[model samples]
Target: MSTEQPQSGDPTGMAGPVTDDARLFPPLQGRAVPVAQDRWERLVSAVDIPQPPEAVWAALTDPGRVAHWFGVCRGNWARADCEVMLDFEDGEFFWCRIQQNSAPTADHPGRLRYLWRWVGIGPVTSVTWTVAASEGGTSVTVVEEAVNPPSDWRSWNGMGWPGILDQLAAHLRTGTTWRWPWRRMGPYLQVPLPAPPFQAWEALTAPGAVRHWLQPCAGSLAVDDEMTVVMGDASGCALLKVTRLVDSGQEFPSYLPYLEFELRRPRWPAPLAGRIWIEPVGLHESLLQVFQSGWEGVGIPAAVVERRILTGYWTSAAARAQMLLRPPGAQAPPIGPHGWSLSGGDDG
Candidate 1:
């Protein structure tokens, strides 16, 4: 196969243009191209192990030993909250959190599940690793679910997993993660927000206020006290329901919607749950920031939806903020790169 890089419109903030050559190849010959509408993708990688399941399980469960083959891991094995940092030969790094673990059983000797987040990004991806004892050796499999990753990420990750798994297998047999050549990509787009202590709490709680800002699609909000919003197309629409709301009381309002939204799309999961806060930086200016934990699932990635939602919300929020603070006769500035503009020429 050709090693020449491909070109695509910039997306993941990676340097240079992205190309189709960077994507993962089809698993089967003559298989149809996977459509984005499916909302989830699964990549499975397996390797044969010359060691026994106990030895393989030890390497898999011991964070310190696993780091020797995988990447740097920091956390207590006794606790489930360990964080792992995977440094690729390319200088790129991935941060992952351990979410699930099951002790080895007779049928399946060892299994582990983890959630990964690109160090600086907003969403979380997930991976599951399984090991089983077989005739004269152990069999290991790694399964990953990428939610809303930039298109190029899929291929990059697909290529990388095999090598990592191979290292794991080799380490189990010979005890070392072999080195490989890799390069770090470019930076990503960063969108900043203002501090909050926003207008009145009523702005978000009132029906009229909520309607003014919430984008309309083919969904509705329904629940007892908390509200649920459902919107999307034929493939699927996400359902976000507010389960709890409290400001500065330890929990944040954003968590309610974030959790509900994620639950609705179990196949494609988000990595983390975060608090929402509104702080005031200027006399009448406020910032609404949402800090979320990452999650992973098996469909159209969440990164794609996150970018679109961020762009839309920022544009709309700016417009609304201006309308609230500007004088009656003054008009708000264009909100986004593509908004309409008015010339200085006066009307006849």
Candidate 2:
């Protein structure tokens, strides 16, 4: 009796494709060509609930009820190859087609995996939902895999899963729906600076200084042949080892540059690897930008934490610069919108 649409495709709410060319960028070079024959890319998101698997399964299968939790459900809710519309209250919608759905088997119960191809997009995205009955309740896992999406798509999707999963968990807990109505955390941060000058201001490149500013706890630092800084933090630390360093002099994009790191701790939530860019505004001033994706485990929104950490890093860097130039008793000036501060030494 639930109003939720069935996991299978339905026909009543079907609509034409919504194609917006501006939002879809041209495919990256070699993206159309299969990168590998056995390329099996997957992104996994999971949440623990204190509810039974059957309850979660009902929510997953009911179209009208699912709409309450995610968004408005339109289209036939009972067949494959049917268009599914997720219409938001803000008058926005994403069009997807069901590609595959697998029922629970002996090894797995209450598991559903389906392919979702967005209208006008190049690649079809695969989403897998698995429910396991545990001692307390059920643990639900959602995995999404996109094929050769642009960098922007990957970045946005990376930060988006946590919020969505959070809503899913809340719905399961209270039998009510939840929606994320805020802007993504990444675009809100604006760090302006040129690449070359920023690279020159790499005072933190030194192992001693990196340990002092970035890594508070015990860790090792190493620079690779490409001049990337590799760092590891204390045990059970969420922060991964810093792997790459770029000179601001390079003609990179105005956004955060790509970074590579090796994760030692397993418990650190999503965002296993990505890039970070730092721009030096002045001799002692710099702006930091981070673009990361991928999660090792579930829980805790990584994008929110990354933004907070980046803000702190910038603030600390400014303070460090002031301390280096100014003498004792000299007051530090306020950081400007562009991340620069006074560079004169105090005469106290």
Candidate 3:
């Protein structure tokens, strides 16, 4: 069934208590709350299908059928202690151990519970899928909980469901799933920060943060403020407009705060955009990153020159910014999200 909206028997709001400690550093909707005792986050959402319970159950349990919806499911469903694999097209996959599974019945319905995990993004998240027969169709609920997952992961997994459920419903009605996997390619940089992320956050968003790390510039740039950055380097002087400010938005507001800007490149036509992502690595340290993409707008792509610019400028500058933000004796944190090449890929 398609993920339509709130239906009867659906979870109308968040489950679990919003404990007192959780209120201190409030979580963005469907986001992780690290300040609280439980470092993990919880997300609950539901989808309605026009088919009956057994159809939904079949679409879920049958390996060949499930493959058309999301990831391909492998392993024997008949074995109670079997290990199932969910492999996507890009070779990225997750392994899950079936915690519980009930075949759909006339009186009640059915449910499936599994513990899931993947590489790059670590942390085991318990996932639960419940299906019940309703008046005209079936209602399905999906719940995921992970302890201290990477901020982007929490957000990515949470936001990626409805579309998947869409694929499920489509595969049930038609024959094939609609979407595939892809990753953005670009010169990316990550810099370490001092203890306590909030303190590191100040260094990222404080007035002139971009100018401090990026280039010497004109315009009054500051946090909670928007301005233009005018700078020059080997590539020549260019202007960038801070298009939007999201203090702590997306998957990891606390761990990853953001500042977005649009590059005004008149010569190269495609829209050039950049993002400054601040990610807290541990309670004592954080990582700052810079990324640029949208090279498809250009006739002659100078990605090598761009990589030199990113590493030569931002990488070195981010190191300097780290010193500026950290205490004198504190060790400099490492940089990464490694394997990002100056040489381009199709993901621009």
lDDT (CA) per prediction: 0.48, 0.48, 0.60
Go through the candidates in order and give the clash count of each. 33, 33, 3
Q: Which stretches of candidate 3 lie over 4 Å from their true place?
A: 1-37, 74-79, 152-154, 158-160, 177-348
After TM-score superposition, the amount by which residue 154's alpha carbon in candidate 1 deviates from its true location, in angstroms, is 2.6
Better of 1 and 3 by TM-score: 3
Better of 1 and 2 by lDDT: 2
lDDT of 2 by residue, 229-292 (tens): 2122221233456576544445446643334554333434443454554443333334444443
Q: Count clashing residue pairs in model 2.
A: 33
Q: Write the per-residue lDDT of candidate 3 for residues 23-57, one digit (tens) a residue.
A: 77665667755663335678777888889998888
| Model 1 stretches astray by more than 4 angstroms | 1-38, 77-92, 120-122, 177-348
- The candidate maximizing TM-score is 3
Instruction: Please report, as a residue range, the 10-residue window in candidate 3 with the lowest summed lDDT.
Output: 339-348
Sorted by lDDT, highest first, which candidate order results? 3, 2, 1
Tell me the TM-score of model 1.
0.41
Per-residue accuracy of model 1 over 1-348 as CA lDDT, tens digit each = 966554465444464333354455544668665333313556788888888877888887876776688655544441357765654322224556777777667765677888765432324567888888888888888888864343344675665478877778777767665544321122121112222233433354356545444433433333323232223223333344444455443455432121122223434444223233444333433434333333333234444444333323333433443344445577555544322112111101
* Per-model root-mean-square deviation over C-alphas: 25.2, 24.6, 19.3
